[model samples]
Target: MVNSIKCLLLLSLAFVPFCHCKKEQGVNLYPQFYDQSCPKAQEIVKSIVAKAFAKDPRMAASLLRLHFHDCFVKGCDGSVLLDSSGTIISEKRSNPNRNSARGFEVIDEIKSAIEKECPHTVSCADILAIAARDSTVLTGGPSWGVPLGRRDSLGASLSGSNQNIPAPNNTFQTILTKFKLKGLDIVDLVALSGSHTIGDSRCTSFRQRLYNQTGNGKADFTLDQSYAAKLRTQCPRSGGDQNLFVLDFVTPVKFDNNYFKNLLAFKGLLSSDEILLTDNKESEDLVKKYAERNDLFFEQFAKSMVKMGNITPLTGSRGEIRRICRRINN
Candidate 1:
């Protein structure tokens, strides 16, 4: 009997690591995670986001990009929401963020509403995911059920934000490599790039292309010359770094395939945007396919968003549910 029990104990111990591995890797987030805990969570986020979008349709794009910036730096744990504090450097100060990222106030409003209904129950990380989905739906883009139960990171990674997030001037290979580091591929990269269809970019983000290509004092020949001339009116060689330009002039406020369409015409606003066509044949083909088929682009975009949201989430007891998004819970 002692020998039999010893053998059983060893077998059970062998399975322990496997079970833990499954839990860690599985993450186990689902659409219904908040269904019972806070039944009104999704409704609260949607209503507030809809109100914000009504006031300024661009707000939808800002909220969507907020989630992207959050996930890319620290795996959708709301680290991007954190302000600089003891032992924590804010990702907001990162190059890709700085003056570019917005929509923090909207998130705060959503958190306030959720706290009223279920105090300390809903996490800011999950709030960001839901808000992103609501933003997409509000802007006539594809909608996907956001998996919930993401916990907030106790610390933020400023270096990760700088190194991991792809820059507008990054070469196509570099951008693809950055996405790959986050477990994304060419399809996800191109499809997620479709989000640019709705947002605006500052003049500084693309001024290099307008004034100099290859460090030569000449405009990038790859850009549509006429389009560049029109851009130069607002985005001059000097000053106007903060000047805003709609990413997709065709359908700026709507999330559509017009971004890809503009790319095909060489009217893409950012070097990053034009590179989809200029740099790699595979991405170019995908861009053309998306431009030709709105449904295909929408479908892939939804899937890619979901995949992006699932990046290295802190679930179970891994991280805290932050009371205030801008600061870690005491």
Candidate 2:
């Protein structure tokens, strides 16, 4: 028995380097728990995100921003979660755009349903996490099965948003550094960038990258001309929704390898996405790697999500199960 154990240990150690080399391999991050009813909760969460938009169309962008900001800052904390006092416990950031009032209403409705079905049982943080997952699934990728039981955060940090989240126009290295801080590898970074595969961005976000092609601000750039031309029509150099751009062309609502193919065609919409091809050969290699293996991308996406979900989460005694996501329970 000891010999067999030793053999297994040795075999694992022997394969370590190979594993490391393949770490940059593009792969899928689908959750292993996917099933007919397994993603039912996630489906509910997606509806909630969409409803947020439906309630207040303007809040749609901000709500999406809130999700990305929250997850990128400290995993998927329910920091976006509110309490009864109308007071946010964590670092109090600015309120979500009032235009999102309708969206907040939708979020409230979803929470109410869960509360009715399993009052105080589900964590708002998990809801946000699942919402993000559901959003991705709705955008056109395989639905990833997220492990449940995430608790709400009692402490919100406005500071986290400025410090941790990557800026839209930051260099590839800057983005890498931020991702590394989150314990994500290059592959994970590449995979996460795939989120852009189906979302829209404002022209303001990538204008500098578009016009300042030779400028220091635009390092190692290679954006597609056709895409740029399209952007020009909607967002001129002088003024427009610079923050606007689409992540994926095919099945924009589904999360899949289409983002990678976009990269391959030099049609990646974000400066961050285009920069991957120029600054890091490995990142570009990953794009190709993932593009070729849809299943692998789903697998990696699942694992990376698990890792992302575990980030500075409001675990243990840090938070509460809010009766409503927008207001405190007075």
Candidate 3:
């Protein structure tokens, strides 16, 4: 009995500081507490990324793009995790009716693996970041160390019309302007574009750049040996389908700094991505910096990801703890 009482006293003393702590309203602004770290979450994330990569080789590129678009558009609400009709929410981006369903299908596999290991512990936001990095690594790209602990947003803006998701044809200035709205600077914009190192783009996204926007004094994109010729054949200048072309020549299934290098040599697939390297010296210099120092690219990617994960979080009573990332309260 005496020993039990003494142990209780010690426990009480240990908790005294925490118990006495008072959150002074308006006085202690920015007061924060470090949430307990969960290794299980990280393990599950790694598993998901690897599983997704193995499941579908094609999805690596699209999944990485989805991660970038999600953060850039709505601060990573997992907004990319929506169906075509926007009726069903998703832990992974919806595959049905999507041009990039294969990639989202891989994401669905990852989400399932994570659910089995640690149900509701990993957020869709963190999974997106991890999956992006992993997809790149699997495709022989850089492996960035991304920090975790981002909470999933229950409130996803369904309508794409509401957010500013830039299309493949956006100009250099337009891309920069849209990125700024997300609190990213020129460096972030250029660094993020490195994602193009692996993804594929349809001819629809670049036909204008190849035919209408190319010439002496316009934009000199030195076609990669025969990439231009291939484009001409696939999407004939006269009349042809305008929806078939992969972005990267080296590895369309990986992520790397090759995208910037390609731009340096004039091989960018989309007008917007190419314009960044040629339209402004500052932008060009930033891309060069990322291409040279992949470490810097990884660091900035991690920082940008953290920033993206924090936007418009559902805290307190605003949202409920979702049992699944796809469906709400239901």
Which candidate number maximizes lDDT? 1
lDDT (C-alpha) at residue 173 in model 3: 80
Ordered by TM-score, highest first, the candidates read: 1, 3, 2
Name the regions of candidate 1 deviating beyond 4 angstroms. Answer: 1-24, 213-217
**What TM value does model 3 have?**
0.74
lDDT per residue for candidate 1 within 268-329, as digits (tens), equals 99999899999999999999999999999999999999999999999888999988899998
Candidate 2 weakest ten by summed lDDT: 94-103
- Give per-residue lDDT, candidate 3, residue 72: 56
Residue 298 displacement in candidate 2 (angstroms): 1.7
The sequence of per-residue lDDT tens digits that candidate 2 reaches over residues 39-108 is 3555566667776645543444334445656677667766654533433444334332112212345556
Candidate 3 regions with alpha-carbon error over 4 angstroms:
1-38, 84-98, 158-163, 213-226, 237-244, 315-318
Candidate closer to the true structure by lDDT (higher is better), 2 or 3: 2
* Per-structure clash totals for the candidates: 0, 52, 1
RMSD of each: 4.2, 7.9, 7.8
Worst 10 residues of 1 by lDDT: 212-221
At residue 88, candidate 3 shows an lDDT of 47
Lowest-sum lDDT 10-residue window in model 3: 25-34
